[model samples]
Target: MELMNGVFRPYADSFVIFFIDDILVYSRTEGDHVRHLRIVLQRFREEKLYIKFSKCEFWLNSVAFLGHVVSNEGIRVDPAKIVAVRGWMRPISPTKILSSMGLVGYYRRFVQSLSTIAAPLTRLTRQGVDFRESDGMIAFIEARLSLVKQIRSEAGFVCPRRAS
Candidate 1:
């Protein structure tokens, strides 16, 4: 990825982003997009790097990158991520709490006051803190549910209630 970054250093964050081998070239207008694409393709050629034609996507209004969907409407957590969070088990220990936090942290930008909402779990992760099953478990469930609700609302997905 360093090599890729070096190749596109001039364009980084102006109209391009590099994540490992994936390069996203973005522009506001069709003409600008074509010009940006040409520059990126030229850099790839200069660096002797090849992109798989099958993986290349161009002129998309929105695209999924690094688990979030980017569009004119703005970035949002992917629905698949919401589903995964929905299925997350209640944290029983500090380790579990940390792991859950790691996953939720990835989408922290989409949810408001995420750090405040996750304070209960965060407290349990501190040294010398004992994990209280009942209080912490309730907080975990509430936090997870809050995240799902917020993400769903932002993504404009109406989830049907599951039958008991």
Candidate 2:
């Protein structure tokens, strides 16, 4: 991954984002996109790395990278990834609680003060903490409900921009 970074260091963030073997080149215009794609491909050629044509997609208005979708509207958690939360059963153990937290934590940036919102659930995970039905169930339900509300709003990690 570090090697990938060095290979595209000059263009990182401006037009390209590379993770391991995946390279996503983005641009606001068709002409600029072509230029950006050329630069990225040229780098691959120079470095003797090969990209499989079958796995490549071009000229898309939106693309899924990692777990989120990047598009003109800004990044959002992929709906498919969150569908499981809709039917999630109440967690019964510390491990289950942690798993629930992990799911929400993945999109923590979209939910403000998630740590505070999930405090009770977090406490249930700590050693020597008694996992009472009242306390744990209330916290778990609250956290899950909060996440569902946020999902309904279609919120996720949207980068802030300064006023022009």
Candidate 3:
């Protein structure tokens, strides 16, 4: 990957970027797009690397990569992943709680206060810490549920409103 990065270093952010096996090319004009693809293909030829053509896409207005729907507008949650999030049950054990956090942690940037909010549950993971939800942990769960509900509504998740 470092070698690939070295090859693409000049075009980073402006035209193309690579991640392990994926490459995304962005251009503002058809002419520029053609030029960018040429440059990338040339680099690939030199590096003796090849892409599986069957998985490639071109002339795309938007693309989904690694759980995000990327487009000119902005990134948004993948509806499929949202479905999984919505289906998640309240975690009962320390292991389950950690697992849930691991799943959700990918979106940590969207949840600015996550560390503070998850402090209680995180403490339960520490050595000699009782594997029980303390008062703070309960509050964290409540806050998490509220946040998930808001995200669901934003993503057009339709359901009967609960009585608060």
| Most lDDT-accurate candidate | 2
> Scored by Cα lDDT, where does model 1 land?
0.80
In model 2, the worst 10-residue window by lDDT is 155-164
lDDT of 3: 0.69
CA RMSD, predictions in order: 7.4, 2.2, 7.9
Query: Quick one: how many clashes does candidate 2 have?
Result: 0
- Candidate 2 TM-score over all chains jointly: 0.88
**Native-to-model Cα distance after best TM-score fit, residue 9 in candidate 3, in Å:** 2.2
Give residue 136's error in model 1 in angstroms: 1.4
Instruction: Report the C-alpha lDDT of model 1 over 1-164, residue by residue, as the tens digit.
Output: 88887898989988898898888887767898899999999988988989899999888988888887776555667778989999997666689888888988877767778989899889888788756657777888899899899877853523222222
Deviation from native of the Cα of residue 70 in model 2, angstroms: 0.5
Clashes (backbone N, CA, C under 3 Å), per candidate, total: 0, 0, 0
Per-candidate TM-scores read 0.86, 0.88, 0.72
Candidate 3: regions farther than 4 A off: 126-143, 150-164
**Better structure of 2 and 3 per lDDT:** 2
Off by over 4 Å in 1: 126-132, 154-164
Residue pairs in candidate 1 whose N, alpha carbon or C atoms collide under 3 angstroms: none
lDDT of 3 by residue, 1-164 (tens): 78778889999978786786778887767898999999999998998888788999988977886776666555565667667766766656668768867866776655546677667667666656554537645755675675575455553322222222
Q: What does candidate 3 score in Cα RMSD to the true structure?
A: 7.9
Q: Best to worst by lDDT, what's the order? A: 2, 1, 3
